[model samples]
Target chain A: MWDFIVERRSQLLINGFNHVYLVFLAVVFATIIAVAIAILVTRLPKLEPVANAVSAIGLTIPSFALIGLLIPVSKIGDGTAIIAVTFYAVLPILRNAVVGLQGVSPTLLESAKGMGMSEFTSLYKVRIPMAWPVILAGIRVSTQMSMGIAAIAAYVLGPGLGTFIFTGLTGYGGANAFNNVFVATVAIIVLALILDLLLIILGRLTISKGIRVA
Target chain B: MADVATAPNAQADARERTGRKRGPKLDAEQLIELFGIPLIVVVGFVAFAIWRNTATLDSVETNALPWNSIWIQLREHVVLTAVGAMITVVIAVPLGIALTRPGLKRAAPVVVGVANAGQAAPAIGLIVLLAIWFGFGFWTAIVALVLYAVLPVLRNTIVGLQAVDPTLVEAGRGIGMSNLMVLRRIELPLALPVIMSGVRTALVLLVGTAALATFINGGGLGGLLNTGITLFRFPVIVAAAVLIALLALLIEWLGQVLELVFRPKGI
Candidate 1:
């Protein structure tokens, strides 16, 4: 294992970086899209159940299946991988964002209206800010989930350390096979922990003092 | 309805949520979920069937598209999910109950913390590592699936049991119910909803992860996908993916049904 590390030190670093980068990129896009759709659902209200049901169904589809399903259309590349990661990433966040935005107390919104705040202003100044904590929670979940899904997406030639796992699988009986998969697995676990810690810190720095859980 | 004039949407949202918690008693939203999932699966399978029956296939596609092999793979996948979930429940629920008991109460969070950390490992990585260690096969996949799924059930079981009202347990004891009786008759029923929800989640997780079992020669619809991808056969890949997705949906639907059926009557 030590020699294996020495042999592929730079390649390991690049794969690890790519893994984080892919998940991070997909998560950012998912958060934005989910939040926007959540806002719309909240505004319509009738769309709530539909949105919930859609998310439930969406989340049910396995990442493996989704990656395969997309291959025909997206043709087995980073596009398919990113799309699949973003697809899964969106659901938990969308559900949370919907709940978060709707969780803004009705009285508070009315108060914002009484203060001469416009609809947009109230949503911007009150609704979203108030919902930030829950949305951030969703983002955290999405980020973590995306990390795993992105690993699987590597089967489709997606950028990531998952290549090591697949590579290890291909050479199953070889001396370095276990170490290869082991390194990717450990690297992914470490990355996931680091990202989760970062999200917690982000929540700390961003959550309003008034609503801080302590 | 009267309050709707004042707070139409939130009132509806609250009612919707409450209706869901109240369980599948003909509520519109619940009914939609109850029926909508199966409807999607039915339609998906129909499409898959039509394509499978009619599509012109190359020699590679023809070789991969046999019904016998597909059925075998499907059976393997379902068995992996079902058995893995059953074992997970057996182990996780009992352990969870033990943890919440007085003797093991303090260990609950520590166990949950460790399980949560274990979850950070990617599913594919875990499966591959385990396969390498255990050697590739169905049992290896089952073990991987069990490890991946146990945390949710365990966590939910502890949380659910802890949430049971202590006074109710005391009441049972006050009436000469033994500790075990209080647990069986009072606590488990009250906690069933939460625990069952966790079980449902674990079931779904098992379905998803079981697809990865094909990597270790565990034999599932993923074999079709592996064949398709490696052979560059589009039909095979799509069929495999869709079938796997459909199976997952069906399992999710079955889980919801079980959760409703096993729910203690009064609660």
Candidate 2:
């Protein structure tokens, strides 16, 4: 077992890094888009329902189907995988952003307005700061969810930790297949734990003390 | 945070408005607009997919499309998901209840933390490890699916049960019901909606993730997806994708129907 681990250490690291890269890029992009849409919908009350409806529908579509759909237009690769993962990650982030913002008291918003703060200023300076905890909660959910889904993207030939998983599947019957898979699984799980811990810590740091206590 | 800042103001407003009638019930038209537009868009996408695939139906015979293969595949998928979902419910509901117990608050996060780690572990990775340990096929897939599905069900069950009114539980206790009786007769029923929402979410997620079973030779719609990719048959791919999405929507709709039929009166 020690020999096996030593031999496969590089492969394990590669797989781990690949998984992280895909998940990170997907979450970052999804966060940006979700925040943008959240801002847009909150600014225009009429679009709130529309934005929410779209997010709901987006959530309903399965990850495989989303990736499969992209294959026709984008071809199968990391690019398609990233797009699918991003799409999958969007709803939680968007929902959380909306929830966090809407959760803020109307009076505070009104006070900011009364004080002549610009809408953008009120959003960045007041709404977002106040909403950070809720928003981070969403991010925590999305990060974990995306990490799992992103690992599966390897089946589509997207580069990630899933490679070992798929290779393990195909190489079933071989002596090293089990070892490869075991290593990969441990690596993925460890990576996921690290990411979750990081997010929790980030959530603690960014969210207000009162909110954290709550 | 804003709520803390604005509570005094809201209290003043609340007092002033105490004599006024509440606004009209949520508008049906607006509700329709909220849910309908996206439903239409998704349906449109599905229709387009069906049309595109059907246009090629003449060139390929039905027998060649792996219809027989789908039955074998679906059996594995369904069995795995059903079994996994059952295991998840079994473990999660009990754990959820225990966590909400008065003495267990400190340990609740630990349980949830472990479950969160389970959720974070990729389906592929979990499936792979199980396949290695359990030697692949049905049981491995089931284990993977269970781990994947457990967090939502457990979390929701805890939240739902926690949200139940403490007064109601006290009332049950006052009326001479034992703890188990109160739980079964009162708490479970009250928490059913939220718990079911979690179950619904788990079901949908399981259906999607079950596709990964193909990687482990466990079989499912994933077989169709894999075969399509390998054979470069776009129709097969589209068909599998469409069927999976439709199944998710169908299940969600069924959940909605169940919710309506079972919802307590005057809720």
Candidate 3:
């Protein structure tokens, strides 16, 4: 294992970075889209159930199935992977953002209005800030989920450490098969932890002191 | 992670604890799921059947896209999911109970924290590694699936039991009930909803993971996917994808119904 690591250190680092980068970009895009849709759901209460149903049904669909469906239209490679990862990434954050924004007290909105804030301003300043921690929690979950989804998306020739696992499988009887699988799996786990810790730090920096939870 | 299904249970808990104005609202959400899922399943099945009948298949597609083979794959997927889930519940719930007991209670957080960290590892990576270690087959796939799913059930079991009102447990003991009696009569019933919700989440996770079983020759609808992609058969690919999605949706709906039907009322 040590020899394997020494020989493939740069290759391992590149794959690991691509995996993290892939998930990170998808999660960021997902957070934005989900939060915006969540804001819409908050504004139009009727859209709430529709949003809920979509997210609930959405999460249940297998990533493998989605990848299969995507191939004819999207062809193979990073686009399919990104689209699939972002799709799964959206559901958790969407659910969380809706919950987070709704959990923001109506009274706070009323007070913001009383202070002469517009609806947009109230959302921008008061509601979103109050909801930031919960949304961030959603982002963390989204990031974790996206990590797994991106790995699966790699089956489509997508960029990631997931390629190593598949390679390890195809070379099942080879001497380095276990090493390949073990190294990629461990690297993905480590990256997920680092991302989660980073999200916690983000929470510390972004969340309002008054609303922040220990 | 909430895994989507747990969100409703959390809502239910909030409603129970806070007496929130959420009544009838969730009924509508449930109604959408209840009515909508089966409809989509039927539609997808019909559409796929029509497409399968109408579409011209090449020799490779003809061999790979038979109805009997599809049924077998579907059965394999379900069996893999169901067996894996049953094993997970059997292992996770009891272990959860043991961990929450007085002597082992301190280990709860330690276990959950470890499991949470472990969950971040990709499912395919785990499956591949396990296959390499144990040799690929149905049981290896099942083991990987169980390991992947056990965390949600275990965490939920612990959380559900812990969330039970202590005063109620004391009240049962105060009335001269034995520890086992109190657990059966008081704690388990109250925690049933939360626990079932977790199981539902696990069930959904299992179904999704089982689709990947084809990778290891464990047999499932994923073979259609694997075959399609390698063969570049678009018809087989679309049918497999649709069927898998429909099956997952149907299972998810069943899980929600199970949560409603099995959760003891009068909580």
TM-score of chain A of each: 0.98, 0.93, 0.98
Q: After superposition, how far is residue A101 of candidate 1 from its true place, in Å?
A: 0.5
Could you give candidate 2's per-residue lDDT for residues B53-143 as a string of tens digits?
A: 5665644434435446666776777776677778888988888998888789778778866665555556677777888778767677877
For residues A135-206, what per-residue lDDT tens digits would candidate 3 score against the true structure?
777777777777777888889899999998899988989999999999988888888878888887887898
Clashing pairs in 2: none
**Global lDDT of each model?**
0.83, 0.69, 0.82
Q: In model 3, what are the clashing residue pairs, if there are any?
A: none
Candidate 1 similarity to native, TM-score: 0.94
- Looking at model 1, how many pairs of residues clash? 0
What TM value does chain A in model 2 reach? Answer: 0.93
Residue-wise C-alpha lDDT for candidate 3, range B1-267, written one tens digit per residue: 233211111111111111112232355666788899999999988988988888888888889889899999999999999899899999999998888899999999899888877787788999999999899899999999998888878887898899999999999999999999998899889888878877888888889999989888888889888988888888778888999999999888888888778767685
For model 3, the superposed segments whose C-alpha errors exceed 4 Å read B1-26
Model 2: residue A176 alpha-carbon error in angstroms: 1.7
- Return the top candidate by DockQ: 3
Instruction: Give the TM-score, chain B only, in order for the candidates.
Output: 0.90, 0.75, 0.90
Q: Give Cα distance to truth, residue A125, candidate 1, Å.
A: 0.8
True-vs-predicted CA distance for residue B115, candidate 1, Å: 0.3
In candidate 2 chain B, what residue range of length 10 has the lowest lDDT sum? Answer: B6-15
